[model samples]
Target: MRILLLGAEGLLGTTVWATAEADPRVTELVAAGRADVDVTSRDAVRRAVLDVRPDAVINTAALMPADLCDETPEAAYAINALGPRWVSQACAGIDAVPVYVSTDFVFDGAGSQPYPPDGYPRPVQTYGITKLAGEHETRLGSERYLVTRSACLFGPPPRSPRARRCFVDRVAEKASAGGDLKVVDNVITSPTYTRDLATTILDLLYHKAPSGTYHAVNQGVASWYELCRTALDRLGLPAQVTPIQEQNYTTAPRPLHTPLTGTLPDGVRRIRRPWQAALDDYLVQYPALRTDERDVA
Candidate 1:
């Protein structure tokens, strides 16, 4: 399949690019980052997609940071909401499938149970609101589309200069510097590995799975504090971990508990690896974290 990948330099996008390039199923791949095309510009998105004429357009592009989205609603809406609309429209022109990556933030976090793919969304902040808008736009713009909602993705550092460092990277940084870590114990989420997610997406497309919204995440849920402890223990990082509440972290309102689970169609394979296992795989890449040369995930 010929594929056009947007946000090719992001945390998840970087993995998607590498995964696609190496996969024999992907016959051709075209990567586009912010430098190549501004997704906020409808004409640019349309032109790029139409020009590429790919069988699939995987859109990983977005203004992802919740705090940043809160500070800039207009830019958030433009990139996160309208950008999907534009990409889907272009895909429609060539009968290509549109694959949009959404977030777990769309939920209100009031539910005690894990959220299914079709769970009702009640966005608590600007970021979630805009992402929800993007989801709606993606659905409206194409008849055959896949919207995969994921959370807490961590892997290699993002290549985009504008992207923020992921949670794991931040933890590694603070621990390596001998700084105490004040992590939230209440803000729970279904943390996933970026490479795992990228593989799931490609597998879904290659197998021609049903087109609909799906929750692509790891097998279990974790709070920031639990995740921090797991990383420190696994990587042998000696940083002091101080447990804290959600309110102590940032000014932006956060859903205290939003764990996503797969509701994939019957017969489709799920990304069932646990978060800790995925984290172990991620830690293998960090030489500084390894105590010995043979240490592996």
Candidate 2:
């Protein structure tokens, strides 16, 4: 399979690129970051997809800075919403399957139970709204598109500092610095591993999973505070991390509960491990983090 991975330099995209490149089924991988493909431009998307003529086009691109999206709605819509639309159109034109990675943020977080794939979305922020738009457009435009929603991803150590800004990374930084950490207990969700997600996506392609939305998150639920504690415990760090309410945080309004639920579509299950187990695997992959233990020992 020839695959064109959009946003191939991002936190999750990097893992997807590596996974595809390593797969024997994948004959070609055309990975591109924002510098290579401007998703906001419809013409650029058409040209790129046409040139690649891939069997699958996986999009991991988004204006994911939630706070920035709140401040710049137009920019967020152009990239997050319209970008998917363009990709969908291009994929439809060439009869290629398009896989779009969405977020759990599409829900408002009011439900006490985990959200199913078909659950109605009521996003609370500009970021979530735009992403939801992307989802709807992709679904409406392409018949062979797979829209997968997930949350709280951690993965292989980033190649650069600019790429290292996920929840786990932040916790590691504070723990390494011997600084206090304040995590919001009010916000809860399933945190996933990027490598796991990437592998699952490839499984979906191999199985020719039906074109529909799917929920793929790590097993188990956790508040931000619990996630932090798990990381600290894994790293054997003694950091003062306080649990606080969401209102105390500077980040824009967050969903109270964004855990995704439901079995993967038939023939599309790559990972079903607990989130903590996945975190442990991620930390093991980073030699720097592993050495931190010896230094402390």
Candidate 3:
């Protein structure tokens, strides 16, 4: 499979690039960061797609910080919504499948149960609203496409110096320093490992699963506090982690519970492991991310 991966330097994009490069089935992989092609520019996207002539174009590029989105909705819409539209339009011209990485934030988080892949989205924030717009644009621009939604994505440290550290990394560093941590106990989500999500995405493409929308996340649900505690426990750290409600800690309105739960097409089995298992593998892969041995003692 010849694949064009945008946002190659991002947390999920890095793992997707690495996994695609390692896979025997992937014959050609063109990894493009923002420097290589700007998704916001329709002409640039079109040119890259025409140049690569890939069988699949996977776009991981997004402006995801909720505060940033709220502060600058136009910039957010341009990158998150218009960007995918450009990619989808380019792919449509070349008869390639466009795979868009979406978010669980698209839902309003009103329900207590995990959301289905095909559920109607009622986004409450600017970030989710723009992402939902992106999803719509992608569907409108292409006949064949995939929109995969996941939440609380964590992975190895990013290559870009400007990229913000993920939740696990920040918590691990703080715990290693023996600092008291206060985390939100509400705002439930599925903490997905990028490696697992990347693999599942590739598997979906390889199996030729009917492309619409799919939830690609680890199996379990966890609040921010529970997730931090799990990471601390895995590292054998005794840091004091205080759980607080989201209402007290956050200024932005967010979905209280948005865990993704769904299956792929019948022939293609879901390959995602439980969240705990995936998290363990992540720690093993990046041992330096753990708390210092001296700190643990």
Candidate 4:
């Protein structure tokens, strides 16, 4: 099966690309980052889809940096909301299943527990609003669509210096530079590993799961501070990270409890692994950070 992957260079998109490319079933995968296809441009997106004519289209594009979205609302809306709309429309035109990766920010973070897939999306920030709008447009545009919402992501890791800017990178940078790190303890959610999410997305596609919204976060949850601590501890780095409230760090307010959870369809299952273990796996990739067995003494 051939698959068209949008935003293939991004964190989630990169993971999806690696996973899909490795799959023997995937005969041909046409992967496009922002350079190859401008999702915000309807004509460009439509042209790319028509040219590929793949069996499936996976959208991992978004205007991230929630605070930046608030500062530039128009650009945010155009990319986050309208970009997915174009993908959905293009997918519908070619009669292909469109899998849209969404975020936990869609919730207002008012709930005490993990939010369900069926729950109404009530985003508080402009970033969340635009993402939720994208979800609506994707749902309306195509009958064959899978909307998967996840929380904080830690990978797919950097291919080059320019592309390295995920949560883990930020923490490591602060630690290495001896800069004071203030992570929000109040903001709680799952720190999803992109590889796990990518595998699950492929699984759902294989099973031909029903078209609707689903939560694909890891089985557990943590605050941003806790996640940072885990990342540092695993890397064997000693960095004093102060836990603070979300309000103290950012210009825009964030939802306090955007953690997500829901039952998965038969094909897909929640990735049951601790964030610390995932961090360990991540550290293995960076040889400079690996602890020597001889040094254990």
Candidate 5:
């Protein structure tokens, strides 16, 4: 299947491109980063989608960090909300399925249980709120669409220089250096591997999964503390990791618990590995995580 991928240099987008390259099913992929088409411009998005004329368009571009989104809400809304609207409209014109890569932030983490894809969203911060709006725009704008929400991504560092470093890498580096880390314990999230999420998206589309939301996160959940500790332990990196109940605040409010779970459409199979297992696969990619392994004598 021919595909058009935006944010091709990003964490998830980069993995998606690489995975598509390896998958025989992905016959052709036109990878487009911001320079190729700025989604904020309706005309640009329309032009790119129509010109590429792919069977499907996967949009992974966004103003990522929560704090950045708060500092620049207008840009956040423009890219996160309005961009999807334009892409969806363009996809509708070409009868191509539009797929939006979304986040767990869309839901307020009040509930204890893992949330289903169709669960009611009550975003607490601007990032979440804007993404939720984007979700609506995608669904409403397109005849057929897919919104896949995942969280706590860890994989190869994003190709874009501006992208934030993966959390796992940060923790791994600090721990290897014996840094004392105070990680939030109660703030739960689905730890997703970019490769896994990308694979899920592709498999879903290949199966012709019906238009709707899909929770694209790994099977299990972990708080920042547990996540870090697990990675450190697996990598044989020694450090002090303390689990605190709350994180010191700055600008944005975070949901304490927003682990995602979902119902799969019939006959559509997805890679639903647990986050811990997925992490093992990810650690293999960044062998530096095991740099201390030889030093463990």
Candidate 6:
């Protein structure tokens, strides 16, 4: 399959690029970051898609920082909502499948259980609202598009030195500094490794899974505090971690519990490994994490 990946430099997109490139099934891969194409501009997106003429277009671009989205809603809507629309439209014109990367934040997190793929979205924050809008726009733009939602993504650091590190990286850094870490214990989510999510997506496409919304996450639930502790343990660090309520952290209203749980359509049974296993694999890939341990010692 020939694939065009948007946001190729992002946390998830980087893993997707690596995973797809390593796969024998992907015949051609065209990677485009913001430098290559501005997704917010419909003309730019359409031109890029037409030029590449890929068999599938995977859109991973988005304004993901929830706080930033809360501050600048228009930018969020443009990137997270209309960006997918433009990609889907372009793909539709060329008869290419559009794979949109969505988020678990689309749900309100009212229920204690994991959210089903078919659950109605009631987003409380601007980020979630915009992502939900993106999902709808993708569906509207193409009948054969796939929306895969995951959450709390952590993965190998981007190749760009200027790129910001993910939460797990920051946690490792803080642990190296031997500082106290305070994380939210109330906000539950499925902490997913980007590589695992990328592999699942490839499996879905390889199996020709029916086009629809799917929850692609590691097979467990955990709070931020728990995830942090697990990371520390895997890194062999003795950092002090304090679990606090979400109210003590930020003023933003976020979904308290939004772990996703559902099977992919068309009887495609994709087995998601546990989050712990994924984390272990990530640490092995990025042995730089052990630098923190050496520093502490």
* Deviating ranges (above 4 Å) for candidate 2: 158-164, 291-297
Where is model 1 more than 4 Å wrong at Cα?
265-270, 291-297
- Candidate 6 lDDT score relative to the true structure: 0.88
lDDT against the true structure, per candidate, is 0.87, 0.87, 0.88, 0.82, 0.88, 0.88
Residue 218, candidate 5: C-alpha displacement in angstroms: 1.0
- Displacement of residue 295 (Cα, Å) in model 2 is 6.0
Clashes of each: 0, 0, 0, 0, 0, 0
Candidate 1's residue-wise lDDT over 183-253, tens digit each? 99999999998888898888888878778998999889999899988987887778789999998788779
Query: For residues 1-297, what per-residue lDDT tens digits would candidate 5 score against the true structure?
Result: 899999888888889999999989999999998888898999999999989998899999999789899999999999999999999999999899999999999999999999998788999999999999999999999979999998999988778888777899888877777678888888999998888888888888888888999988888889988999999889878788887776474468888899998876554444477888889998987786686453432
TM-score of every model?
A: 0.95, 0.95, 0.96, 0.93, 0.95, 0.95
Off by over 4 Å in 3: 266-270, 292-297
The TM-score of candidate 1 is 0.95
* Cα lDDT for residue 37, candidate 5: 87
Instruction: Specify the poorest-scoring 10-residue window by lDDT in model 5.
Output: 288-297
- lDDT per residue (tens digit) for residues 1-297 in model 2: 889989888888889999899999899999988888888999998999999999889998888668889999999999899999999999999999888899999999998999999898999999999999999889987888999899988887544345656788778776777678888988999989998899889888888888988888889999989988988888878888999999888567898998999887566555688998888888877756653654542
- CA shift of 149, model 5, Å: 1.0
